[model samples]
Target: MPEETPAGTPEGTSTARVGGTVDVGGLALTRVGFGAMQLERLEGDRDAAVALLRRAVELGVNHVDTAQFYGNGFVNEVIRDAFGDDDGVTVVSKVGATPDPGGRIPLRLAQRPEELRAGVEDNLRSLGLDRIPVVNLRRADSGPGLRAEGDQVVGLDDQLAVMTALRDEGKIGAIGLSAVSLETVRRALPVGVVCVQNSYSLVSRQDEELLRLCVEQGIAWVPFFPLGGSFPGLPKVTDTPEVLEAAKSLDVSPAQIGLAWLLHHTPNTILIPGTADPAHLEANVAVGSLRLDAATLRSLDAVESRTGDIVLD
Candidate 1:
């Protein structure tokens, strides 16, 4: 584990450091971290991308969540070009989705038992890593048009078999579930599910039960879209009155409030808010020190009118 220093905690952010630090599925990471999805959308400025990544590490961000599907494998390339030799950072990547010939992520079950090895290998090749510290089996079928009550948790036996085989072969250190339901998490626990990555926010509380289960079991609950993703035709979570009021009272951005709430809201929850801009990345990491009062947290929690659903399509 890297030693935490004063640089890790910026001045006047809060009395406590950036959500302190914790071990997520044996990978030591700061509670507040960066996501690499946005980096995929960067059209140019490769140097800016590298600088942004290095600055994130300088700000005490060690855990980075990414996937090969993002930008059709270009996101991992950004990570590799930026920190390919830096082992201090723990890079978490996902499997189960791939791009088509036209370079679009289609909705399909691509991570079957026979396909698992290639998925892991592809990630390894893209990120230039010997072994992925953590690999999430993203349930491709967990999105819209699927019945969460039934048939969503199918192929666990086969998926787990391949995951276990890869672990035994020393290709992956841990296995996790992404975009899955609470019942799917329950079914995945006995086979050593170490983390759960779901679309969770103050407005989107669909995964509340799943988050609680992760807390109780000491499993890492990584919430993507901490400020909400840009899903077409869905509501945004950042423009809420409660969040704005809390941001004014706390003298911080609404995005920071959302992140701080997630940090204060749970002990095991780890955030992976992504951005390609260097300044925004710093602001995101600074949320570790942004603290919220009890009343503000309560008010933010009680405002149901602002809450939205998990928009996973």
Candidate 2:
């Protein structure tokens, strides 16, 4: 069984028993959180993204996931600007990579221990927080020309050791891994992993096994791209016929149905669906109230993806 909460506290505040908790230090968090990737100036304007982050908290989202590479510090700034005074929020940021001088989307890896430390310090400076709730090691194979400037690439084990040291020093509350393989997750488990963030959706179930392991181990499983990638593809999760039908039955949008499926699928699954529009943010938060029955969930699970396997590690 999971650890029990002390008496007299609110149910979801500290324990989050309904949705399993991912321990950031000793803090337990709800599985459903917000991903702040979309808060940057992607297509043009950033007002929509700002509104979305603000509305997420208004709608009861406590966990906010971000990275130093996101918009070269734009996302973190937005988060800090939005909820700097709100003590109820838990802001999670990642290190291990930094944006190029010219400003880029995908970041260049800075795997050296010193570079990692600087990245964490930069995150603290940007988020305006003494210690972030969780810090993930953002691992990527491509984008930007920055490389690990050492004789060897920093392995997952080495990264975990760095994060563990930081955690012990109270610089970060918990440690997590992003865009890593199941093998990497297993390797880092002994170092104390609290959560895993991967690209998973109805159309992308490649991380199914990793999600299951997180549930069994009482770790939080946060999915990044819940709306598929940024392209027009076949109806995967949100655009599926079955999902649309279920949404129609529930009198909600397809996105809500998709998020509902994630929330109901497992107690550990957390959906961090990002959006620039405040309307979309409100819709995303409304998903928490939408429930999928067993039949609908089964139908959603039955829907298959035609795309190639999603490999983030």
In order, the Cα lDDT scores of the candidates are 0.76, 0.70
Per residue, candidate 2 scores C-alpha lDDT tens digits across 1-313 of 2233356645434233223434544666545567787677552555656667766766667778888778878888877877866448888888877676553335566776677788899899888889987898876532112344553287766777778888889999888887777888888888778878776778767778888888777777777766565333323576679988998998988878877787777766667777776777766766655657889888898988555433332
Candidate 2 residue pairs that clash: none
lDDT of 1 at 37: 83
Clashes of 2: 0
Give TM per candidate.
0.87, 0.81
Residue 129 C-alpha lDDT in model 2:
88
**Which residue pairs of candidate 1 clash?**
203-307, 203-308
User: How well is each residue in 270-298 modelled by candidate 1, as lDDT tens digits?
Assistant: 88888988878878888877768889989
RMSD of each: 3.8, 5.1
Top lDDT prediction, candidate number: 1
Q: Tell me the lDDT of candidate 2.
A: 0.70
